[model samples]
Target: MPSKSSSHSWHVFTATQDPHHHHHHHDQLSYELPYTMEICMTELDPVLAGKFFRRSGDEKSGHSAGKEMTELTGINEINKEAFICDFAFDPCGYSMNGMDGELYSTIHVTPEDGYSYASFECAGLVNNDDDDDIVHVLRKVVQIFRPGTMSVSITTCSEYNNEVWRKVAGAVEPLGMKCRSCAVDQFPAIGSVVFQTFTPLRWKNASK
Candidate 1:
């Protein structure tokens, strides 16, 4: 993460509409606290840069191959997990085993509440379907971390094409959060998309 001081030209736009309209069109738009994160160009590893597009067994490197879905969505007492070692990679060069094969990133979810955290990991496997699991897990964290705040930011500085960033935007933006990019210089060949969001002040009534 780049220091907040390292100034770089940032392009701000809404993934949906400008200043999300509240219900009744009368509810005042909440003030969004300012926060920024820097995504370094080096942060994107080769495995995540689309290297494991659609290869069968995890041949790229000796590690885990295929997708696994763990039930982190605490609700009904049900545990479900699946792997796609037999399936071939999809046309997009990712796992064809639904969204599980498409996700290529990881996020550590430590909810504000006492919930055993979980890690979502994928080596080079890139696809669109992976968003739900990622977002679902992150959303839960956001609720636990800053319940009053309705926004969150996913920061990365990995070397990736615009398509990867757009996919990230598509996954995160809908969850009522703003997406931001860092390390613009890294993706000179391809434009970088950065987003901004606010973290609610937990001590709104307390003195500074």
Candidate 2:
């Protein structure tokens, strides 16, 4: 079962140290600035999934305050969902909301099959001048994915430069992981990197 606190949660994408220090508390501008992604995944918990799908497709959900929230779509139907992208171009800032800490637009994906992945452009914060901070963020992501699994792969770096990625892979190779691999592309100007994974479904036997 999904924990009570983890379900139907809210997040604030702030560029300021104090997110609550609103530019205008009573106006729509308060929410317009923050890039928000409402997370709706099917298998965060099966019990929740059953309850959610039980209602009529047009029925209002308690979590939505009478607004109808529909069924999952595309990759969202899987047990794991896609990483939410944040394209805000700004410096990092401290966050004080739920699971609060220093937050970044960077998104990391972790599958229950013991594999973790990270995808960011070389021009992003992951490859910024601060090497220590970059490693620390990656470590935090690893902890989120598999608490004890040290092996990870840098699956996507949008700045299609192998030499730069090689340097990054080498830097984190010693971080208590069995292996560190780089998944890259050759001519990114004409092509992009795409990653895919599968989810397993189980069935029971029937007797005649």
Candidate 3:
């Protein structure tokens, strides 16, 4: 049985008030530029998740093995424009950071038994409903590591009240997921955060 919400067990990543914001007059810093902070944490499918596992006799260094995984798993394709720096843990795990111009994205993987977990973060803006950067990247990340249960959150320093927040669920649901819970919170300083949890539709139905 599976189900989903703000059940944020782990903070994949978060925003911080820049120390350089020496304006003590204000409690929080303002987003001078409009961009979305998109993050996703997923329990990877057990069988497919084994890709991050180390082979029994393979003597490849963690760095070497991780490099292989990055290439083998199609991570390089996620952002052709970004330069990627990736690494693999001693036994089993993967991490990557990509930079494209001023924007950046990161991915971390933890192969915990059948509960292989992966999280991703990207900085981009949802320009229009037609085609945008963040959504496209999110979709590619999802395809790379299909999750049995997934939770996603998006925050923007722009007018995303009815815009980017809704787009989070809309973009992922078509991928065989059912939104279990959604929570909205006003950013302490400015902007808004939309958090949603999900489980595979198949699992949702099974639970019922």
Model 2 lDDT, residue 61, Cα = 29
* lDDT of the candidates, in the order given: 0.31, 0.26, 0.69
**What does the lDDT come to for candidate 3?**
0.69
Segments of candidate 1 deviating more than 4 angstroms: 1-119, 127-160, 184-208
Clashes of 1: 15
Model 2 off-target regions past 4 Å? 1-123, 126-129, 147-160, 167-171, 187-208
Query: Each model's RMSD to truth, in Å?
Result: 15.4, 18.3, 5.9
Estimated TM-score per prediction?
0.29, 0.28, 0.78
Candidate 1 local accuracy as lDDT? 0.31
Q: State the lDDT of candidate 2 residue by residue for 1-208, as single tens digits.
A: 1112322222222244553342223333222112111111122222222222323353332433111211221111111222332121111111111122333233322222223222222112233333443354444333222222222223223332333344334443454332212233322222222211111112111221
User: Which wins on TM-score, candidate 1 or candidate 3?
Assistant: 3
The most accurate candidate by TM-score is 3
Candidate 1, 6-46: lDDT as tens digits: 34234434343434333221233442111122221111223
> Can you write out model 3's per-residue Cα lDDT over 154-181, one digit (the tens) per residue?
6655345566656666777788877787
